[model samples]
Target: MKWQNSLKDYQLYLKIERGLSKNSIDNYILDVKKLIDYLDANHINISPVSISSEIVQQFIYEVAKTVNSRSQSRIISGLRSFFNYLIFEDYRADNPLELIESPKIGRKLPDTLAEEEIDQIISAVDLSKPEGERNRAMLETLYGCGLRVSELINLKLSDLFFEEGFIKVTGKGDKQRFVPIVDATKNYINIYRYQIRIHTNIQSGHEDTLFLNRRGKQLTRAMVFTIIKQLVEKIGLKKKISPHTFRHSFATHLLQNNADLRSIQLMLGHESITTTEIYVHLDRQHLKGVVEKFHPRK
Candidate 1:
């Protein structure tokens, strides 16, 4: 099969069969394209169905000269997965990437904010400004829902089901799940909606959007990062913090409070429990407490 046709089909497979996010699918495609570009630059005519293990290894080695080990490992993994998919569909007789080895890299744990630190950051917002109410609700939603910044920004007014005690969240790959909302979070959101947002002349496309900028447009990812960064600076938090720290804290807190890993996985919108397991490291006390409370010898 032609390389272009194979790449397009593989992209569709990743989206439909694997349920990967659009961003993830694009990254995988880019990895494959990178390999193709390398081959073309070297004047090598290799088809996806006919490439040998040696050429694949050489391409990887050449890529290693340009990218970091972590990036290289990711490219290797993405390519391996693509090749495996091709083999599964019987498009190729043999997998050229079967002998490829991923780089040995340590697991990098996500940064989590402490409950008290989160409180401090939330408290640092000057509530006198018109945006303060929105900021408060935004932060509350981010931590409460365990939402990624992109999800938070794109959340809609129609997604609220307060009477049902749940909020519909559109997660990665456009997957939708309803998460329960507490009274405090709902109250903060309502206050922002009625008090600040109601008075503003919202832009046309952003009328249904929950969070808006000063100009009544939808909040961008960079704006969310800036808001969190400014709050961190105000509180003198030394730990490396970002919008994602709130999400990490949300999962960590729930896991510490005896919430099930499977439930947290669903809330965090992670396809694998392993992605949610990183939060397990955050609650050392929970582990010790579990051992102390359950182990007979303790």
Candidate 2:
């Protein structure tokens, strides 16, 4: 099959069978398109099915010189997945990347805020302003529930189950999970929803979106980052932070307080235990106590 046709099929497979998001599929396609561009520029005549491992390695080597280790590893993995899909479809008989290795890089621990630091950041918001209440509620919910920025902005009125003590979070790939919502978080949300959001003329196509811009539209990810950046600066915090830092802090705080890793994984909508395990490294004091209390030899 032609590479173009194969690419289209691969995209459809990722969306339908693999249930990947459009963004994810686009990234995968970009990876393959890079390979196609390289082959075309170099006047390599081999078809996708007939390409040898050496040619693929050459492409990887060229890419590695220009990209960081993380990006190079991602591109290599993307290509490996693409070729595996091709092999499954009987378009190729051999995999070119079976022997290839991903880059050796340690997991970078996520940045988290201490409870007092978070309080200071929240206190820095100008509550005298009209949007102050709304901003406070938004930040509180973000940190309290460990929500992704997307989840926070896309939250709906119907998704609020305060009486049931949970909020439904639609996570990556549209997977829905119920996260327990404490009264403190729910009360803030209710105040903003009823007092401020109720007065806005919500723009069309954003009627159901929870967070809104001053223009009554859905809040963009960039807007969320901007809010966090302003607060970080206002509080004179030296560490880098984003909306996601609230998420990391949520997980880290919970783990520090002895919340089970499995419970945190569920609440955070993490698919892998390894992802949640990063929080364990966030608190060295907690780790020392765990070893002292749990290890038989200790």
Could you say which candidate leads in lDDT?
Answer: 1
Compute each candidate's TM-score over C-alphas.
0.91, 0.94
Query: In candidate 2, which residue ranges exceed 4 Å CA deviation?
Result: 291-298
Query: What is the Cα-based TM-score of model 1?
Result: 0.91
Error of 2 at 178 (Å): 0.6
List the pairs of residues colliding in candidate 1. none
- What's the lDDT for residue 71 in model 1? 93
Any idea what lDDT model 2 has? 0.89
Q: Residues 1-298, candidate 2, lDDT per residue (tens digit)? A: 6779889999999998888767789999999999999999999987788888999999999998899998998898899999999999998888999998989977888988999999999999888876788789889999999999889988988898898999999887788999999998888888888889989889998888777888999888898889889998998999899999999999999988889999999999999998899888745776788889989999
TM-score of 2: 0.94
Best by TM-score: 2
Candidate 2 clashes: the total is: 0
